[model samples]
Target: MTVSVLVPSSLTREAEDKREATRKLGYVARAAAVFRVDRLVVFPDSGAEGRWGDGFVETVLRYAATPPYLRKEAWGKRDELEYAGVLPPLRVASRTGSGSDDSGSLRQGIVTEVGSDGRVRVNCGLQHPISLPEPDEGLTEGERVSIRVSSRRPVRAKFVDESPPGFVVEASDLSTELSRDDAGVRIATSRHGEQLSVDRLGDIVADTAPRGTTVAFGAPERGLPEILGVAPPGGDEGGAETERERTDLPADEPDGSRFDLWLNAVPNQGSEVVRTEEAMFAVLACLSLTE
Candidate 1:
């Protein structure tokens, strides 16, 4: 099952500094890798942008998502990744066959050169770029491709039709992502949305797993309702209410617009504030489970 996770560019709005922001983004990347997300979209939230806007968020996420072997060549020195040292390792294991077998392991490669002789030079973090037979339609210079490496000693590898081991980072408009054709079971997560229950989660996973799903999350203090200008449940009421009361949301119809199902991933909570990264783990733990 394919899963696409959409996070606002203002995700680090609550961060106290650049270092802290980078650390927070690391966990977000960790969640994506843990859940095997196909896409990690950083949607624009111009109004709520801070010292770190779309550029910073996108750059850091892209850097974090890049495989360790290709990082140096894929992304050169950049100001946005100043605190990249603190980012946690994702450790997304290779899904290709194991043992000393000919099936080979999957590795990400960058096309350094495309030749007229139906061959292309790929840099898959080897000692040097290697040239392999061109793909059916041919590949372009600078295009990222996957290679299946059977023998590293003699360097036997071939281009393969597949994605790398980690989630791909993307920057997109919020509206554009919501309208995609493959955007199956669009879910908006919020404290004021419907409360998530054990029974409900099983149904959601079973139903949506086959078709794929897209889930959107809001930044701290600024939720999807606030971002979309849709009134939040309890309607600007005071914050002294309990979690049970906050999750006592209205019926499931997108909370008026945009989403297919509105959800309160954590129904009961002792902490009044739930950070975006925290909520991500809480929500995805239930959603991405397989039988």
Candidate 2:
């Protein structure tokens, strides 16, 4: 299933420094990679943005998701990437074995040249670019493609009609993101939302697993209700209330956001607060469960 994770641009609002901000973003990227998320979206939260805004968060997240070998080619020098050094690596599932194996290994490659003779030179993290017969559907230079390598000695490989591994980072507003054609089961995670119990999670997964899933997380301090200008259950300013106590508040009204459900993924938290990165891991872990 396609899984899209949404985090506010003010995700690092709690970070004290650039280094810590970058490190926190690394864990977010790692969580996305671990869950095999299809898209990592950064929604605007201008009010809560700290020193760095969406630009910094998007740049760091995109950099962290890109494979080390493809970083230089994918993104060149940029002023927004000054703190890139502090970004931790996301060891995503990509081609690991050398092309020596006969069974073939899946690898992502960028087209360097598309020859008239139906051949294209691809650089798939190899010592040298390899020339292979292009697929019937033509290819263009700078286009990313997937290839399966059968042998390294002679470099036997062929193009595979499949999506490349890892997720793509994007920046968009919450409304626009939810309006996408592929946007499915739009869930908003909050500490004051409906308590996600074991019995309820099954129905949630069943409903969302078919089309896809888009789960949104709030900032460290500001939650979705505040970000969206809606009064959270049991008032907007206070410590998190127990699930039983929250049920007594008024039901959630459509706050102009397209969220299908507001879920409290961590129902019985021992701590007073949950960081965005921590919430990402916890919420995704629960949603990723299968029947």
Candidate 3:
């Protein structure tokens, strides 16, 4: 599926930094905003369900000459977080609430580079390049935000940042949560929420086969040791959850579509891979459109 390239306000500062870095390096880093298709599920546009046919893949690869910054401030914070402190940390809840209550506005920009795994470097001009806003400080970083068309000048979005990414009303399907909203279908967590419109979502599926209805909470291949208790002593045999096992599709869908889409794009099976976020977006965009 294809994830649309969007320049959020969060990366403005990073874009400035990249520009400066490029200037120092004796060249301007041109950036363009573009989406990277991670998985294609139901793309009627072209190709099979599991892969982004050569044509679509080329389209994603050639969308922009340079990578645009499509990330948020919290990305840096999460990466830089050190496990040094052992004491109880100060926790701050937003009085403004999880959803945008004037927390801040996002500026847009372009991308500067596109890696093989679909990581694109975007460039947005943020005010300061100093300390980034901290997540625990009530400042949401590039946290997953679900933005939907509300009206001419207004957009509606829900800010969620606490629950895992799946609905667990029943004991059987605790692995994921899918929320249907005006924006389309959102597979999000209590913590990070991503918005996917119908068109964008459909594009992704037609391009990349999605593993199933539920996005990967954490793929089985990359399953962590302990959770609320999904795994047992020996845990999975690494490749236990086959491509077919991972999907929630009914019979009649194409073979290998669900497995390749979600497993490869969404989860990292210990390899140095591309950003799973991009893949997640592709599938989500499809679900949203279909819903």
For each candidate, give its TM-score against the true structure.
0.87, 0.82, 0.20
Candidate 2: tens digits of C-alpha lDDT, residues 31-66: 999988999999888867888874888888988877
How many residue pairs in model 1 have overlapping backbones? 0
Q: Where in model 1 is the C-alpha error above 4 Å?
A: 97-102, 115-118, 233-257
Ranking by TM-score: 1, 2, 3
Error of 3 at 273 (Å): 9.5
Instruction: Indicate the worst ten consecutive residues by lDDT in candidate 1.
Output: 236-245
Top candidate (lDDT):
1
How far does residue 190 in candidate 2 sit from its true spot (Å)? 0.6
Give lDDT: candidate 2, residue 100. Answer: 57
lDDT, residue 56, model 1? 90
Local distance difference test scores for all models: 0.83, 0.80, 0.26
What candidate 2 gets wrong by more than 4 Å, as runs, is: 95-103, 113-119, 133-141, 233-256
Candidate 2: Cα lDDT at 260: 72
Highest TM-score: give the candidate number: 1
Q: Which is superior by TM-score, 1 or 3?
A: 1
What is the Cα-based lDDT of residue 171 in candidate 2?
87
Number of backbone collisions per candidate: 0, 1, 53
lDDT of 2: 0.80
lDDT of 3 by residue, 1-291 (tens): 222221111111222233332221111001111122222111122212122222322222222111123323322322111211221211211123345453333333333343444343333333322122222323222333321212223323222343211111111122221221111112221111122334444554544344333333332122211112222212222232333444334456443222222222233235443222334444344444443
Task: Give the clashing residue pairs of candidate 1, or none.
Answer: none
